[model samples]
Target: MTDQLPLERLALWVEKRPDAVWLSQPVNGQWHDFTWAQVDEQARRMASALQALGCAPGERVALLAKNCAEWFIADLAIMLAGLVSVPLYPLQSAESIDYVLRHSQCKAIFVGKLDEPDKLAPGIPAEVMRIAMPYPTMAAQYTWAELLAAHQPLHEVHRQSAEQLLSILYTSGTTGQPKGVMLSAGAFAYAGSQSVREMQITEQDQYFSYLPLSHAAERFLVEMNALYSGGRVAFVESLETFASDLRHVRPTVFFSVPRLWTRFQQGVLEKLPQAKLSRLLRIPLIGKLVARKIRKGLGLDRARILVSGAAAIPRALLEWYQSIGITICEGYGMTEHLAYGCFNRPGQVRFGTVGKPMPGNELRIADNGEILLRCPSLMLGYYLDPEKTAETITDGWLHTGDKGEVDAEGYLKITGRVKDIFKTSKGKYIAPAPIEGEIAKNLWVEQVCLMGSNLDQPLALIELSPAAREQSQEQVTADLAQTLQQLNAKLEAHERLSHFVVVREAWTVDNGCMTPTMKIRRNVLEARFADQLGELDARQPLHWQ
Candidate 1:
């Protein structure tokens, strides 16, 4: 791996292959490409603009927007000016944005291509300089293009050290208050280099930039990795048209949360009804043709590696995709570790395990079964939270709050979160993640949350597949009963799912049912359905459709 930092690598790329297309964007149904030279020039101009506007080096500059060309430009500008970049999730609640901005102490922010700027404007502090991308329609405090055109270019490199603060990424806050993870150029350089090697990212690889860049995984996978490897990064036009955009790009490598993968499965099944599905399965030639068509239509045909992380993927979905010629390698990591810790090797992949730790990272299970990791990928420390930082990293090993064990072949199998394990009133400990993974293996069960805290046996909150809901209510009920009965037989007395509640409404990030990474927020789910779950227990062992 190169010892050069991420910014250094970008500078080198800009100098060497200035004309290579580094970023691709689709605006107004038209695809646009930007070369490294174009990106560097624009970034420098933006940096000059910020400097002219009384922005100082080492100050925090936040970028509040979705995935777009401007996000990259703003980030590079921040780096160029030797400022720390804090990316805020555009889809998050106003309260979340406010918390991150205040915590990071951002003096200036760029809100780019927002669908609801009016809602966000109320949350911004009057003291903070609010800048809008391109031109403003919502009348933000400042505009981007005008500032860039008036300011003199600053071409001199800021020359940041390895320990200099590069970014301050706020956590998704699935639990409580979000902690800003402070990362340095050295830390990200080491982490991104290792990730690039593990992911086998090459210049030929094309990545779809759809996930929230505010998240570590996507930022590293799409942005940092793209710069290091000279790979092309494509931004989806919008969330509503992500599927269409994916088809247009046909990215060689796609990164998605498990939730999107579930939707992809539903889309394929919906197009081919059960009758047609059965008939196609019967004819070998036709089955292959139909499956290929389905994969291509979902923009997964050319995908050399379809990765899902930030949450556990259902083992069933893994197997199903494998059956259709697409190999999904699930990874396991946290924000504190710079996103990737262990990823299943390209060919030597496993369905149920998160694979062995990547090179330069150590993984061991503590006596109590907590997954422990020590790596260069580790963050410098949490911003302004020394107590928490010290507690998280002990003896150089980050005590990942997850419980898991390494298999004989060195594969790491995550059991569940240490705090997420619940005890039944009967005093039996129940791990919901593994049980949910077992149930979600069924194609019909798109999403499941196991609920058993202070109960006799566990019950599941299940979201149905699109194809499953198309069936008659009687058919759906009968199918659920049979599937549950079979699933129960596979589990021990304490682990068996006793009842299932069908959730008609889909869980989404916008709906607050899921995180930006598509992981179900268990604490939120439990709180929201506390009364409903109590009603399910009153009629214990009952299934609701």
Candidate 2:
């Protein structure tokens, strides 16, 4: 096996199996397939067009789009032309987008489907060239078809060295300004191979792409893995059609975050009550048949490898899925490491651990309880921020800000974040994540953020799940209060929660309370609820907003 760039792999697939399906997209309630040969031709044409427009090699080009076939084509085109691809999350604010464009000095951008084109148009400077994707855009200089038709197909392949910069992926910036992560071609090639080996991926595997491709986890797991293994990729049309799309694709490999995994469990429980399903599964011969039917209905019957990452999943949730015959292998990684640190193996399952480090990757717990890592796939550094980069990576070890512990069997379990631990007014430090995770075990809670920056004790701001929204407010409050009481009993004196405040407004990407990858923005949430906190007494144990 050669350690070639993704474009080289694409070229190999084009020569070996030109007619094989490379990408699939839904349009007008139907799926359309794009063959490897077609992808190659379009990417080359786009590359040629970029050169015609005076795009120099090593210049930055931005991509702003939702998940689609055109996004992948544009990325390959950028790499083919020897330019760096800078991907912007579709849900990013116009101000943040403008900041990134200015910071990266992007010369051009490929625009695709956006929620509000007019609102985002001002972010891109008029001097920069704009090439519209296969979507409607009023601010583009040329469309996809026009560009492809106007330029010749580029036949000369620009072979990039392993150390060549591949892309600059900006973080979601939960606390501060987003940092541009500089990843090289060699980093991706190494991480991709490791992922394929760990998951046992093959050419026959199918992947359903619904997560934002801008995140490192999705980019590495879905896009890069498919390129390495010559697998087929299917894109979901929209949120409403996710279930139907999953059923249609019946993917062999599935990866999801903690929130979506909980939603899936809630969906199945809604169809068949959890108590009845458990009773049915206890039967002698009918158990296996019933379990298969349930898995099929949830579009997971054909899934060979199920994985979860991006956040700590509740142990109860994993146990529930295991009861139904699905074992979710939790993975641990970050953008700095190309999301390739460690993973729970298939058979040697541990209930509450993220598992051992992968082959060739070194992991250790620091004296301060922070998890440190040294891997071949580690990123070069943060783009244009040498001082910050130096602070992050010291002595060949990348300091993962997360606190963790390693067991005797080499399994690693993340405890909480070092930065996330806050001090109360009483001069005691409390780690709110573990407490929040305990409260999150309650089915009614959709999202929770613990706040106690300078207050006497920590406070929980919660948003109820959709199913819980149907219940009366009184019933919801009673249930939440009971859950909070139980959680407080398990906590120490300083770590106990002072009050539970149920917020009426839902936290979502559009509302700026959530990052693109579905992680809660603690600073944003605290800012939004700053004024109301003064109304509640610190002595109160529970209150409903």
List the global CA lDDT of all models: 0.83, 0.87
lDDT of 1: 0.83
Off by over 4 Å in 2: 537-540
| True-vs-predicted CA distance for residue 405, candidate 2, Å | 0.8
Q: Residue 223 error for model 1, in Å?
A: 0.6
What number of clashing residue pairs does each candidate have, in the order they appear?
A: 0, 0
Model 1 quality (TM-score): 0.95
Residue-wise lDDT of candidate 2 within 134-204, one digit each (tens)?
87654798899999998888888578878999899999888788899999998988888777877689889
Residue 365, candidate 1: how far off, in angstroms?
Answer: 0.8
Model 1 residue 59 lDDT? Answer: 90
Model 2 error, position 276 (Å): 2.3
Q: Which parts of model 1 have CA positions greater than 4 angstroms off?
A: 135-138, 274-285, 537-545
Q: Relative to the unseen true structure, what is the Cα RMSD of model 1?
A: 2.1
Best by lDDT: 2
